[model samples]
Target: MLREAPAGLPRQAELAATPFFPQERYQCGPAALAMTLGAAGIDVAPEALVPQVYVPEREGSLPPEMLAAGRRNGAFSMTVPPRLDALLAEVAAGNPVLVLQNLSLPWVPLWHYSVVIGYDLDRTELVLRSGTTARTTMALSTFEHTWARSQSWGMVTLAPGRLPRTAQEAPTVAAAVAFEQANGAAAARRVYAAALERWPQDLALLLGLGNSAYAAGNVAAAVDAFRRAVAAHPDSAPALNDLAFALNAMGRRREARAAAQKALSLGGPWQEAVRDTLRSIDAAPRRR
Candidate 1:
């Protein structure tokens, strides 16, 4: 039987009212985001970025064969084309969306992630979530290609009624937020799907789903999810660290180290776990 997604952690709508990072460069993970939701008394299931395995936090090492298998799975197997259609449909309905895109290799250069927070129906432009990039509007035609290279993506809708209580009011958006706060992985996934039906480019939803997959023991699924999250929003520390951990868990020390270092470079509370994992690797004895 397909493992049903878990539920009952904290809601994501509460956090949407105000993003976790006010600094404007960091992106959060589903687990970390859920923790934040918990801090505010909201519940939502935290997902995983990779399959569940006994990863020694103190060593940050994995069995070599596992790494090979993970790499063999590659990045394309995780792409979902239908999801994009749903996302666009949501946007057409005038809902906000967040999409997380990912690249193949860590050393492959370029900013790895981006956020599709909103759309420009009139200008036919995509309002990106680039922290410091002066250019926010990308022609829809241009974005299509950009999105093509992205590995994973998700969408979040606003719950109009839920938002008014928090100073936000969009039914679709509110429903998305309410679904996140509903407290279960299954419900969260449904909400995520609902939001994506119109806006497939939702960062929070992608990250949340990635985290959920990871927790549910789908390591590769989690990695692909986070990869897309990072691709859509380069500065998302949660995605970065989570990806590093996934790599590490698969025993890809070199890639894991690189991912961990990159995550640290991005800088955010979300990097804390990755940083700790890296430190653990440093203290481990090399296999001669």
Candidate 2:
């Protein structure tokens, strides 16, 4: 696999500056998460994340908890694609990937988390910040064996507006929504804006951006996003409904009523919401 590595990715690369944290028994999850969040410029320590991710009875952190902790610290946390090439691609792009492994047999599982910061295709080895080791090297084949046990589960934590090299539209949008839930509208706005740049006509991205902007008190920006969404998908009732709401918020009741009426006429599942929007526009005081 190394012999025919993907083009543009260096055959050998290491993120020497990535921070390392030694795991305190049953705390590999927090330590690995700290290393990943640190690389993304979060500056949080593993000890600080213990309460957020560590599970005392399970003796380890679950994937969802680990991801949530990253989001709580203002990072865009996402699960990497379940493929070795995808994982290495993120590393080559300078994003350290947090991976779960089962060092023991599947029947007698020993779950652990580690950060992969580099890979040497020439030597067929992957470099990691594992346990108490600042740098640990494992044969590519051996690493795959342990990783496969966990179904190749891996994650990448990144600063807002940054994306994994192998990011896909659906998953990226999903992650942005999750980040919004964990963080706030402002953080999610950045993510949605960044994704919109890549996928200009994506309905979900447009809606997310509009919703985030509206939630952040930027009604004008939300209206603009919804307008674009309506242009891209003229028949989208949700888009029209949102635009109407924003327009009403801005005191453009006349324009809001027009948009809401159109949305109600074309409504599918959003019929009720469109009706509500139209009613709100009607109830709004007229500007004398």
Candidate 3:
């Protein structure tokens, strides 16, 4: 079951060939990072990324820092689910996954980062861009043993406006939030839009888009997003409270009043905010 490629995907898979960069000792983090980010769209050099990702105390690029660097380079460096099938499926779908592994024994743990660029099922080999070599080949079993020690950790970084092929709801939301923080709501708008396509009725995603739109002062867009969110989960207090605020901002006090009332009736954790929304709606001037 371990070597099985995802069904319906091609038996043999290789991503478009990209240039390779060699790493200095303890610089595998930067090398692997450059390979992945370069493919994603940014053309940054590994040396330029070293300051951001490398920590002297850590002796290697930390995974958390690597993710932060991905964000800084305009990608949401997401870790796919830690399973052989999941990793293979991502590669088969054309994503070059940056993986974490222990090159040394687990007890000793020589944490290394490498990019899995392709695989040949017939040969049962996985191709990697590691250290001084591009197209470094290892038996599937060997690769799995090393990778499994690192909890099968792999990044599925996506450039702006692109969504992950193996996305999960919670992680996508976290990435969306981080993307918004790093790139601002305008860039986040694109992320949220792409995410919504996959999870059209996800309340959190809708709220994210709504929040991003509202933060950008795009009240109309915010109203539309929050409305859709409330439609998906009608009694969501947070959604109703936010929708109430957007309507109030648009000077549609009557509608805001109703939404706020429903949220308050739900008596959820947002009740305080719901009461506040109702107060503002009630205080606003009525339309002529």
Candidate 4:
């Protein structure tokens, strides 16, 4: 049996050791990368692709069984700083790594995972296989620092001990999109919270939280979160649309209309959603 790795949240030092890539966004973290790699027959389990620590208010060690399970299943939860260099070396050796961050106004902090696919030796760059990109090839070391300090940077590494033969079973991109679209506010809130815990500056997650809050009837919270997201990434279409919805929910019709217009100007698949929201707000009956 494989000796299990440690269980629980990763330390900062452990995070620094993972390798990086230049083509990927620092926001996705590691788990997303792992899923892609797993689908491609690379090392490690999809869940193990990133370090997701469910560290509650209490500080306690992880169970031995859980640790064993992680190791057996090719997953690892680690720390940062001291482990940084070593982790990078492993990743440089063809192993993949994932990182997560947490920060910003939150109903809860959420986790975002991405995979490190390759690196540049001459440029000290990290390559990443990311969900946000159709192209690969990215810098390594630069992403390391960005990921480390951006909200919260949690890291994990996968060894290339095995290869795949046949097809792999993994979540499809379309399926993931559908899941997010169909997921209820409560579920979206949980996912957003988990991701935000790792990346507070993540505009997408923040906007999603705001939308989810609005959907769940927490108008105030939705507005607050959306405002923060817009502050971080002003050009974000999702943030614009979600903010418009939040404003409308709060009875700020003028501001909501302006926000919807801004979203329309941004122009994305979200344009229709923004337009629909604007029309609904305009048609809503005034409460006595």
Which whole-number lDDT from 0 to 100 does residue 259 have in model 2? 91
Q: lDDT tens digits, residues 51-71, model 2?
A: 999989998999988888889
Supply candidate 3's per-residue lDDT for 68: 82
Of 3 and 4, the candidate ahead on TM-score is 3
List clashing residue pairs in candidate 3: none
Deviation (Å) of 150 in candidate 3:
0.9
lDDT of each: 0.45, 0.92, 0.86, 0.50
Candidate No. with top TM-score: 2
> lDDT tens string, model 4, 1-288?
102223321221122333233223332433354443343344544335334422334221122222232233333222222244444554544445544433222445333445554544545555655556533554444454445444334233222222111101221112112334544554456545545655578776676677677778789999999999988988887887888877877788888888888888988788788889889878977756
- Judged by lDDT against the true structure, how good is candidate 3? 0.86
Over 4 Å off in model 2, which ranges?
Answer: 1-3
Best by lDDT: 2
The worst-scoring run of ten residues by lDDT in candidate 2 lies at 1-10
State residue 35's C-alpha deviation in candidate 1, in Å: 33
lDDT at 134 for candidate 1? 23
* lDDT for each residue of candidate 3 in 1-288, tens digit (9 for 90 to 100): 384567776667777565588988899989888988888777889999999999888788878888888988888777888987777888887788999988789789888899898888889888888888877888999888889888889997777778768879889888888888888886688789898998899888899899889988899999999999999999899999999999999998888888988898998578888888898888888778
Angstrom error at residue 103, model 2: 1.4
